[model samples]
Target chain A: MAADVDVAAAAQAEAAAPLKTPLHARHVALGARMVPFAGYDMPVQYPTGILTEHNWTREKAGLFDVSHMGQAFLIGPDHETTARALEALIPADILNLAPGKQRYSQLLNEEGGILDDLMVSRSLDEDEDGALYLVVNAACKTQDYAHIEARLPANVKLVRAEHRGLIALQGPAAEQALAAIAPEAAAMGFMSQRTIRVAGIKANVSRSGYTGEDGYEISAAASRIGEIWDTLLLDESVKPIGLGARDSLRLEAGLCLYGHDIDTTTSPVEAGLTWSIQKRRREEGGFPGAARIQRELAEGPARIRVGLLPEGRAPAREGAEIATPEGETVGTVTSGGFGPTLNAPCAMGYVARAHAAPGTRLDLIVRGRNLPATVAPMPFVPNRYKR
Target chain B: MAETRYTKDHEYIRIEGDTGIVGITDYAQGQLGDVVFVELPSIGKSVTKGGEAAVVESVKAASEVYAPVSGEVVEVNSELEGAPGTVNEDPAGKGWFVKLKLKDPAELEGLMSEGEYQNYVKTL
Candidate 1:
């Protein structure tokens, strides 16, 4: 009876109308196919289709409306106080993060499992030295904010930037396209952040993106974001991309999708994210799940995430079982799909340490058929990030 | 002239004497997005009405194309292995998935005519 009630509640939530982003009208005007994503009515693909958009992003600049992602500011009395407050939750070295620099990390539970993956950036202005800009997954923001708020000291506060909308311009030509509007953005290196005026609108521009391409993520007032999007589109090198290409591009880049790849059950060490944990946190052991993470760092994790290249055209989708040639189950695919850049099937999954090496042969069981696959290195397409 | 019939699931069967050429409709291909791979039924295999006949994979997901009526597969489109995008480019022409020997010609009467199928698609 209780299970049925829970199911009904879930159905009711699913039936609720999705919210629209600031650029929703632009997507509809461009004839994009809309789909429900992270509680927002998002464009899955434009009229030109996912293939064209994926290729366009690789060769040119592709503009993406990422307004649904949660943006907030962590405010405290000073940089040290703010960084230490955030470090108590995540494993990254926030205190050492230079001004105008961004770092990627995960909010971990007490048991070493990932709560959510996020990007943290230190403020560039000296007047705002105590503020840290945070970007988190759309689905987990509410809970993440509540969790952080409950644990934070009275001096530090979490301020949600509800009136802001975010957009990402990514690809090899992204720098040139953005430079046309904000010339200062051209000098910013990868993982750097700065506040700039984009066509007379105050915006926070970051030289970072999930796609392993040179790109910028610009955040501005929700009302003015549409103007920035329109101004960027004025560049012939920039084309509007949708979530479909976003998933494919990130998968090809070997980046993790929050809910699919890293979840509450997965740890940063097991997800190949130890690099994000700096030396101070690893040695000082002050953050949540530090013991488990440090132990997993010294003694390797039992299962580690690795890239899978399935032989042939058939894609091995998520939930497909990974097995030995003799049919022994070794792991399961967490994210799998057709990689447009590779022109082949690509996947990432957690496999036993023994079977995680590149060039290792494995089988992906799909539809009761054993498809041959190889354990390959990630970023199936080479990353083109500017230094 | 060959007669064409479409199932509610979007599979189409074009009757050519004893042989029936089968493929998904253009609307189905569009809904599936960019076709990346196609898994065709083997020749000489038997298929039942509404049974899984072939697999179509797009960049987004995979879907099954069911047989419109019971039949024995006579030939398959091997060219789709190398050029799966043809399924999106020419869904009705060269992109036909398979040709099957009809088990019963009368079964065609139960399926929708091209005009009726177009009308049905409008209601969706």
Candidate 2:
């Protein structure tokens, strides 16, 4: 009798249900293993399992449902005003961005810490009227929109693309797969965007991704994403992928997850993303954390993010402490896991400048055991993005 | 004929004369998802009932495998070191973790039967 009540409670929690993406029904149809993430019920992996899904994406084209990501457009009457407004919030040189060009950047706090990392792109189509398209972290979009809205000048405005769903088709075979359906997308260079039609549905496609692969991220109306997903899947080369592989793929690519590898306390220079900041921005000192960032750019950050290759099969997961051979703590692993492509455990962490060199030996304390590790260059798997 | 017993933590012990074959129940492996590494207890390591005796690392998280009854580790399934996913593939069978020389057979009485464990898992 008591057991029945317990079972009922479990069912009740499931009934409460989190938010669902536009492709939620399709995910169920595919027999995907669903889990709650970023306040949405997302598929962690399909029946093929995370290992296979990750491997498939590395070798062939993998279609992912990224609708849960927050998409918005920063609008203004002219490009100059819009770009400068964005530049004031981030450390990137948005004012100089060519139309149709996209740049990865971080939103900064007053202390020069990272608020959230995002993709900022200038409107490719002239009809957009100097509007800049932005994609922020899924969990931070609401707050990011509010933050930008409250700070922007009256000439510039923020418009949430709340009804849009995003999809990412990534990997080595992406070009061939997408060219058959959307020929114009194949013409886009890396970091370039194009507003085109996919199966007659208007979409904004970008030849940029977080997986360190040559791929495309498509933004379309939420109501049309399901049709787009079905059209893409009809082709043999494209297979549905889930968040589980998404994480491993990004980890192997050496990208930092917003809440994991970076947070409010981490600075762009310390996170090994100083390259994203232009020389003009670094010298002029205009963004939110410009002073601290400029100083870090001139004088290297005290500690920087670096990759670690643990010697054994055991993965030293997040929060694992990094110590010197003598056992003095020097750093912490922010993101670590088994890399399917490398077929070995890979990790990234922030360590003291002296200990951040590639091939520097360190010990990782994982589950009470000191495991030998070496600081290695990132993107454990070679990035195959088409130039 | 020997009978099997299960702990509330989802560990199972199959009795065979003076020895008990230990492994996590199928329900536990399902909950763990993909098994990446399994840290087996050293042979001859003594363990007390309800104390941690082994470690199971899954892609999701690591869990401690506790002793259902006091005993000395007589042997471990070394094959699991190479293929930890076996715990998810054949959990109740070839994925057994260790074999313990029972310190007191009377302790088995505290464990649940297969029927009881199924009901317990349903409640969870």
Candidate 3:
């Protein structure tokens, strides 16, 4: 099936093939509405459409080709030393991480603002000598790699896994979809990690997802990933989903998209992600911008992340102005859309800490009209992660 | 025998006597990919030619349907409220938007014919 895919050496393959992922042909054949994203042409949805795809994943399983996301590793002599080195750069608790386990963490700048949120998994080994597997966002991969390489010490090494492709099988039926090839995957708990064979292809499968569903993320060699993807999709319950659905799913799940919800101008505390930072990181203060984070944690941040529910049906799109009761411009919408699952328009933005509480009334200046709004709790739909 | 006409925005209308049947063209529904929700005009509501008469919201974007000729709304496709997907499935058939009593049938003279609409969509 992959005869046309000529896999040269890893370095040459990326430059020669122009970075087409394993599902490229399948997407075209299935009549997927493809769009360019982060240098890769990926399907935003199939002929069935984005709305159907979004609802399908919410009710069944949605298979997504996330190969554009950067996957790499950090290798060192032992786990403790590696963890300590990693803690200096990110806000996650790598030192407390157990073998065969993973943690969601943010790579932060020196100012305690988020650079990118990423997944870090400790290799399943007792000797503590293993690589730290990482999956970074597709759009920020280039800058993230450079940032990591620039900060690493002499003992720690960063290596890019260029030949690998990543796929996310998310939603209610994810476990059943993978049980055919990896039975252990079905038994895996949330945030757990393990190496497994997918349709006989060597892969690292993690029980995690961004869509607020029970799911698994599989990373495998690029040449063999197409086989695994095709095999998983053979089940009638599984359908190919796209970025458009992916965004809606994440938004409904209350998960934040990097550039839209969090950026260098916003800190984790202000973004309502202070829970992800370890207690030790908050106290001992070894990582970058620890002092700022600790102070914000104590005194509270000035502006806070809050959900906005527009009174009318018209969507409050990004950059919409947020105002107080007397028409005082208080905040701006960072991300906004009509959440399919919620069946209503929802938005998220930063507002002054005093007005950040749920039920706080606000007005959105949308299209020259003052749209009445209220601060609602996020994830608009409750996340059903298999913990 | 009368002429069927289309607009750049994708609505198509067939004029018969003093009345006309309005709906989105096959090209419009095809470009929209799939329809999810549709907003129709109230019966007896008077609308002007080229004014927003209805709205068809596909999974991708919401688009306004403009009146082909100034007319009074006589009938609407109530079935669309429950099955807007009909627009994507059969835009020119079961997805007909509305039937209106034309104020000036002469406005029909300004519309593009079926052949012209087909050619127009090709350029897009």
TM-score of chain A of each: 0.96, 0.95, 0.94
Write model 3 residue lDDT over A284-376, tens digit each, in one string. Answer: 878888888889999999999899998756666567889997998889988776678888778899999988999999999864679899999
Worst 10 residues of 1 chain B by lDDT: B56-65
Highest DockQ: give the candidate number.
Answer: 1
Prediction 1 TM-score vs. true: 0.97
TM of chain B vs. native, candidate 1: 0.98
- Which residues of candidate 2, in runs, are more than 4 Å off? A1-17, B122-124
Candidate 3 C-alpha error for residue A352, in Å? 2.0
Instruction: Estimate the lDDT of model 2.
Output: 0.87
Residue-wise C-alpha lDDT for candidate 1, range A82-171, written one tens digit per residue:
999999999999999999999999999998899999999997899999999999988889999999999999999999999999999999
Q: Estimate each model's TM-score.
A: 0.97, 0.94, 0.85
Runs off by more than 4 Å, candidate 1: A1-13
**Residue-wise lDDT of candidate 1 within B4-118, one digit each (tens)?**
9999999999999998999999999887789888888888999988888899888877789889988999999999999999999999999999998999888888999999999
Residue A246 in candidate 1, Cα distance off native in Å: 0.5
Rank candidates, DockQ, best first: 1, 2, 3
What fraction of correct interface contacts does each candidate retain? 0.37, 0.04, 0.07
Model 1 chain A: ten consecutive residues of lowest lDDT? A1-10
What's the i-RMS for candidate 2 in angstroms?
9.6
lDDT at residue B84 of model 3 (Cα atoms): 77
Clashes of each: 0, 0, 1
Q: Candidate 1 clashing pairs?
A: none
Per-residue lDDT tens digits for candidate 2, residues A1-387, read 001111001111334568899999999999987877777888878877777778888888899998988999999989998998999999999989998899999999999999899999988678885799999988788889888998999989999999999999998888888887788887899999888888778899999887888999999999998888999998887899888788889989999988879999999999999899998988898898888888888889999999999997887878899999989899999888778789788889999999999999999998688999999998899899889
